[model samples]
Target: MGDKIVIDARGSSCPGPIVELAKAYRNSKVGDTLELWATDAGVRADVQAWAQKTKNQIDSITEQEGKIVVVIKILNR
Candidate 1:
């Protein structure tokens, strides 16, 4: 595990969180973890699907106080 890169997408709508996560992933190295904070409910499924499509590893998806926290690890890149 490496230092986590945090992306705060809170208050952002659909595609915003995923876009930020994608950007972070592109700049990250293998084994690096990304923590995305989003307020949009749809981001949960979006992130999951994006991770699968990109072959990245999702460590967890947690929700607290209407906020979503997605943990993803860079596996291929």
Candidate 2:
């Protein structure tokens, strides 16, 4: 099955948005798309690190309405 997960963590603090992204990872599979929206300035670094640790592929990073939007493509482990 195909699926997409979007986590809106805008207004959250450090680690909060990253945590949500991690949670989304648990339920996601290879080829899945997970979009994370975070307002915390640290989210970009944190999420990138997390994806590196977990072997996920970062598809894109964009800024939307003052929030950082990250789209991660789940990679096969």
lDDT of 1 by residue, 14-71 (tens): 5578788888888999888999999988888898898889899999999999989999
Q: Looking at model 1, report the run of 10 residues with the lowest lDDT sum.
A: 12-21
lDDT per residue, candidate 2, 1-43, as tens digits? Answer: 5578899998878558888887878888888889999888888
Per-candidate TM vs. native?
A: 0.90, 0.88
Question: Candidate 1 overall Cα lDDT vs. reference?
Answer: 0.87
List the lowest-lDDT window of 10 residues for candidate 2.
Answer: 13-22
Model 2 lDDT vs. the true structure?
A: 0.85
lDDT of each: 0.87, 0.85
Model 2, stretches more than 4 Å misplaced? none
Task: Tell me the deviation in Å of residue 16 in model 2.
Answer: 1.2
All candidates: CA RMSD (Å): 1.4, 1.6
